[model samples]
Target: MQQPEPLIPLAVPPDWQDAGSAILGGDGVRRVLVLGAPDAGKSSFCRLVLQQASRRGRPASLLDVDLGQKQLGPPACVTLGLADAAGGVPGLCALSFQGSLEPLAAWPRLIPGTARLAAAAPPGLLLVNTSGLLKGAGRRLKAAKIAALRPDLLVAIGADAALEAVLADHPHIPVRRLARPAQAVRKGGNRRRRLRAEAFAAYFAPAPAWPIDLAGLRMEQAGVTPWPAPRQLVALLDGAGHDLALALVEAPDEPHRLRLRAPRVESPVAGLRWGGLWLDPGWNAHEIPRPPRA
Candidate 1:
């Protein structure tokens, strides 16, 4: 028998034009949900949509829900960015800290946090980019968000059978199925970890240590977890309980005082929320226990 040639992945996704037309077809599209497995070209599709929207002179925003590999902002966060009409560079307007990179472990906060950020986005076409987690609880997490956010359009990349269950639950939402990009290459576990570490390091590259007085500030954990401790990640929240920025807790500089290494936070830090995971000096996240309640 003659041998057939091996298939090679192309550098560009074949369905880009089709996907673009399906997503940006009409002016009625307010919210779009992009779902797919890892390396399925979801982010690339988002960039394409943003560029098209800018060219069309329509205001657009992106709500990124990918905690592990973010397209808009830092890792372990759900961020909202407004597309610059002139420059095409999205600017971070708001963010909510989920703290865990694993979607399965962070779904409890992910669903609600996504909705909150989406709601806070400016009036325009809102494109939501999700993490590449389409199995088991990850699939369920996407379905729950679909129910919660009630997006106007659902963009599903790849032909995973698991997506059927997710799409089946929401028949009213229009779905645009696109083939997985030929150039998509799966990332290994170690590479993912390394990428996360690199993201964290870059986020805190110019961080300066700030000594905060913990006398009257509210400090609490997201769920059942330990109180704010050294080397753990913490969210600096405003009076409205919105995350201003991420900070690393450091050993107390003085009695009843807390120190943090974080970016410059212009907003006044009214509260402190203990993030779900901890990071070492290298910014690699370490999972903590979610102990049973009493």
Candidate 2:
């Protein structure tokens, strides 16, 4: 693959100059994963990289694995897009994982979904935008993800002293630290909820409520046990278990059929799996309330 071209002369800010040159220079960096705390400007930096590529005649795709505060796809899904730097968030291809706000509970699905998205991305500069969960188990998930993707470059957007221990194992990979953009805004709970709601609304629009037979499709990553509860969020998947669409289990109509509200699908669905997400009619995620005693 042709090494991605460097930013057009004087196009990048002084802060990102070295990193940009490093990525576009010597041997050429093909894959990169940008890490940072919440509101640390990871996505902002991603836009810069794509902008440079756009101006220099280089092609690139961005793989966004952040389930919340999503820019490309719905909440709880890992999505990718061939970006237009000037256009901002582009058309998305999604792989639905666990749809909760936090990624910790969905590590099993997140890692594989990330890897699959990375592998499927078109050849060029593949810039990965990660979530802001950067402490404790979140750190471990980051470590595991690095090990799995084996990116060509690791860019940390802020003070990464906490990442030193986990990064110790990968001495061969180079890491670039960039200061968080001063203009980046820190999102509050209400803002986060609003953004997540917008993403979910985009997913549920237009498609009429549809009922599907649970027996016709197979389920994988179906969680620890089968759930028969109402209003639980379930994922419609392909035979290989990629997300085809998301639905609410309105009710169990029979032993093998479910009443649901889901987006229409163009292809046949091969699996029905629930991620324990209890979504209200608006598709906003909520805690699964206790089951009433029989």
Candidate 3:
């Protein structure tokens, strides 16, 4: 593959510049996992690494495991993108739907989904960019991801005791610690929510409502009860279990069928799994409360 063309130059910290160069300078580092708290410049650092690799004519890929603020594809999905630096975010190559915006709520799907997508990345320097969830259980999730991916290098981007704790779990892997660059702007909670809302709106903007018959396809709600109300998010899965598209529930016109506002599904939908949120037509997301313990 032709090396990805360079985008606008990024002004990162001097140490970050050296780290990016060193990574591509060929010390036998292939798979790299970048971790840090929110707004710590993990994504920016990955972009820098990609640009450096591109300049050197090295093929590189990015596995975006951040469901909320993704570098490619929509929120709530782990996407693999071949590094094409011409665009701000790499082009979408593959994805796995975790169905939750928060990494904590999605760990069951997050770790394995990341591993699966990382496995599918095209051969080259695979840079895995993860969600900035580094407190409490989030710390364990980060460590679990490292254990699963077993990346050649772990790039922790900020100073957090939690980050050190995670690094301690895997002593064998080489690590590069860098301060969060000044360019990294800390987004407030409300700002983050607005960003997610905008992303959802952009993703579904051109989609038309599609009606699906449940007669032949498998329907999986599993532990979810009372059936999902209108506007619930759902994932239509292919036979091999990859997501075909995400749809919002609409009132069914017929029994044993579902109407959804989603992009056209070109391939057959073998099954669908219910998500734990409701997304209104206006793109606002509301969590679906879990059923009371039996």
lDDT (10s digit) by residue, model 1, range 97-128: 88787777777788888888888888988999
Question: Rank order by TM-score, top first?
Answer: 3, 1, 2
Error of 2 at 135 (Å): 2.3
CA lDDT, every prediction?
A: 0.79, 0.72, 0.79
Clashing pairs in 1: none
Error of 3 at 243 (Å): 2.0
**Tens-digit lDDT track of model 3 for 1-294:** 112223223666889889988888857788999989887877788888887887778889989888888666678888888867542456766777786888888888888888888888888899999988877798888888988898899999888998888888889999999987766678898977777777777767767887888877767772254565588888888988777777777887589888887778778989888777777666877777776779
Give the residue spans of candidate 2 off by over 4 A: 1-13, 21-26, 85-87, 164-166, 220-230, 249-261, 289-294
- lDDT for model 2, please: 0.72
Q: Ranking by lDDT, best first? A: 3, 1, 2
Residue pair clashes in candidate 3 = none
Model 1 CA deviation exceeding 4 Å by range: 1-11, 85-89, 223-225, 289-294
Model 2 agreement with the true structure over 117-201: per-residue lDDT tens digits = 8888888888888998777898889888898788998887776666565466577888887876666667899877777776766
